[model samples]
Target: MSYKWLKFFIMWLPVIVVGLWEYVRHVFLLPFISMELGNFLAPALVFLITLTLTRGLFAKLEQMQEALQRERLSKASFQQREQLARELHDGISQSLFLLSVKLDRLEHTELNDEARETTEQIRKTVKHVYEDVRQSIANLQSPAVVVDDSWLNAIHSAASDLLQNSGVHVQLDWQLPEGVLTNKQMVELQAIIREALMNVRKYAQATEVQVICHQLDDDGNFDCEIRDNGVGAESSEIEAKDRYGIRMMKDRAEQMDWSFYITSAKGEGTRIRIMSGGDKNE
Candidate 1:
């Protein structure tokens, strides 16, 4: 039965049983039973019937209600995913297509050495943009937000996929509490971390990479940092070589109103930190 029907029946069961008992007592049982005794038995009988029927019915009702709640949540998640996928397809995907066309036209006309180098750089940037957009669209279409630790798993999966054969020893130091980030925040952070790790895999040449996530304070603030002990670049070189990926990460953090910082020196290493505040438990 439906939860509503089961609930209604449970609610009115006592009244229904009592009414029937009273009618029977007045019509027939009056010869053998006193009015006071029937009145006393009526309550006991109602209580017994309610206790017998409602126990299993209440349990079933609870299960049905929980199932309904889960179904609603699933539909909401699906709707959110569809909206995001549509936005990405209409905005970034279309822009990338136009940029790719322009890059192809630019590739056809090769002249001076410097201009050729710049064109090549633009081509690389376009390639990265296309790849990133495709990844974002895929993530939107099939998000793994059902489990509480799905975001963490995604971070680990990204790290594994990128650095598996690169001889980089990656470490994940995840210490954030469960349900600390909203779905949007989690998606943003996952993308940022994946990008940071991809940068490390491509350019860092470091033997050790650390991905750390931790709570900053009691006010629901947290920090996520990606550090690598590799041949770090100078500020100018960082801007030139990894600008596209870095810019994308920065834009993501900015969209969420989070603080993003990058620290890299000649030989020390590189560290990218993203910090955000407020309770994002959703």
Candidate 2:
């Protein structure tokens, strides 16, 4: 019923018919022109040919199986990302935006100097949180357009959108070698860059941002670096919060089988880098 079985049957049919014809000639004909050595070699040669053909077919089948497995994993990951994006946009992100607005109103109320300063701080913190939420949502959502050959273009587009929306000045330096990525790989890489840029817009109030994309080691691997000039984290404790933005970024990197690194200090600014070397064929 299956193509594999059909192919197997077809491959053996020639040997089967040849053997049957030889048997009829030996049994019914008066003089058989078949030598005993030829008779022995005929089956052996058929067996060797069948083995070779089947081995090649099996190898092709294994490749097909691997491709199917990758497709299934990709589909599952995409669905999960989509669901999380919706939840963040409609549930968490909207709530944070509303909370920021409320905090702003509270900050304007008459209060003592200390109280006003505290209120302003709260407002600023909430606004930052809101931005983080929106960025997280964007990172989880699928790209605005279907990705084709140019993953670098998708990364650039996502970075530009984040900078424009957040009013961050960005400098892009991209040098991606041609044909380094397939369509699927490009999609996943685009998602990683999107998350990285979102983190930049939310946490890095940096006046200037730099993004670098290039091939690594001629191994068909690519890496991205996003640096911001804003004040960085004061301590590791500052990033220890159970927040969605950083968590999503890490999750995306893991899903793509990529390596991600973040570096920051109190006044030194922040840098986020992602590298995908092993799983380039995804």
Q: What are the Cα lDDT values of the candidates?
A: 0.81, 0.71
- Model 1 residue 117 lDDT? 91
Candidate 1 C-alpha lDDT tens digits along 1-282: 666776787789889888898999999899999988987899899888788768768788787787677557657877888899899899988998898898788778857888889888988877877777776676667654544476678777777776675878789999989867766677778878878887787788899999898998877679988999999989998777547889989899889988888889978999998999743331
TM-score of each: 0.58, 0.57
After TM-score superposition, the amount by which residue 55's alpha carbon in candidate 1 deviates from its true location, in angstroms, is 18
Query: What would you estimate as the lDDT of candidate 2?
Result: 0.71
- Indicate the residue-level lDDT of 279 in model 2: 42
**How do the residues 1-282 of candidate 2 rate in per-residue lDDT, one tens digit apiece?**
455775966567667857875776578742745577557756776776677667777777887787677567667766888988888888888887788778778767878999988887887777777766665666566443233433556666776786678878778887776667655666656666676676666667777888888888777788888888888886563468754656667677788778877778988998877888744332
Q: Residue 225 in model 1: shift from native, Å?
A: 1.1
Candidate 2 accuracy as TM-score: 0.57
